[model samples]
Target: MDSVPLFALNDCDVMTTNGSKLGTLENITLNPNTGELKFLCVNPSSEESTEFPQMENGQVVVPVDSVETTREYLIVTAP
Candidate 1:
């Protein structure tokens, strides 16, 4: 794992493992008590994936555990 700053993820595109574009990184979710990552809030850029639940603020919530990589895009699991 590399030491990429969390701020680098801002506005980064998020994609599924199978190559489906979900959206852009809007925010991150974490466990306040432990400061552990929980999920990623993605602003809708495409309606190609619906495996994850969405938020009321129009951002799709993606589990951080499902993320495979974080480079130019946040690669996440399809389901």
Candidate 2:
């Protein structure tokens, strides 16, 4: 896997690589042993969110590998 530059995820917006707004990040799931980030739980902004994977609880779930973070957004790679 390629390295993702670390930054604060707090209150970050989620966007697609093509620049579509998904929503704000709600939470993150990680492995305690290896400190590996697994998934990102996000709040869907609108119907535009239907394009990505989501949890049964109605939250958008973005894989960490699909993320590219900036100071403003967690840029999600298109599948």
Candidate 3:
């Protein structure tokens, strides 16, 4: 994975990676043990959302590996 600067995250466009709007970051979940990413309806408090993906109208899982590029925002391959 590429080294993403902290500042870039502020302007990230989640739609490209997670198939949602850029600002809808509330709907996502992450696994703590294996560090795998997946789609969740809503957040469940500070449970270590390490690899969470932004969800939209429909749920879609954006695996960490599918992230082709990320700088200001994440760009993932479409399923």
Clash number for each model: 0, 0, 0
CA error at residue 54 for candidate 1, angstroms: 0.6
lDDT for each residue of candidate 3 in 4-76, tens digit (9 for 90 to 100): 5435544345544545442323333458787555432332223333244534443344555555444445555
Tens-digit per-residue lDDT, 1-79, candidate 1: 2455787887889887778788888888789999888888999886654888987777899888787666688887857
Between candidates 1 and 2, the lDDT winner: 1
Q: Evaluate model 2: give its lDDT.
A: 0.78
Better of 1 and 3 by TM-score: 1
- 2 or 3: which has the higher lDDT? 2
Give all candidates' CA lDDT scores: 0.80, 0.78, 0.44
Off by over 4 Å in 3: 5-11, 15-28, 36-59
Model 2: residues with Cα > 4 Å off, grouped in runs: 1-7
Q: Of 1 and 2, which scores higher on TM-score?
A: 1
Q: Return model 3's CA RMSD, one decimal.
A: 8.8
Q: Which is better, 2 or 3, measured by TM-score?
A: 2
> Candidate 1, 66: how far from true, in Å?
0.4
For every model shown, what is its TM-score relative to the native structure? 0.85, 0.79, 0.39
Model 2 TM-score is 0.79
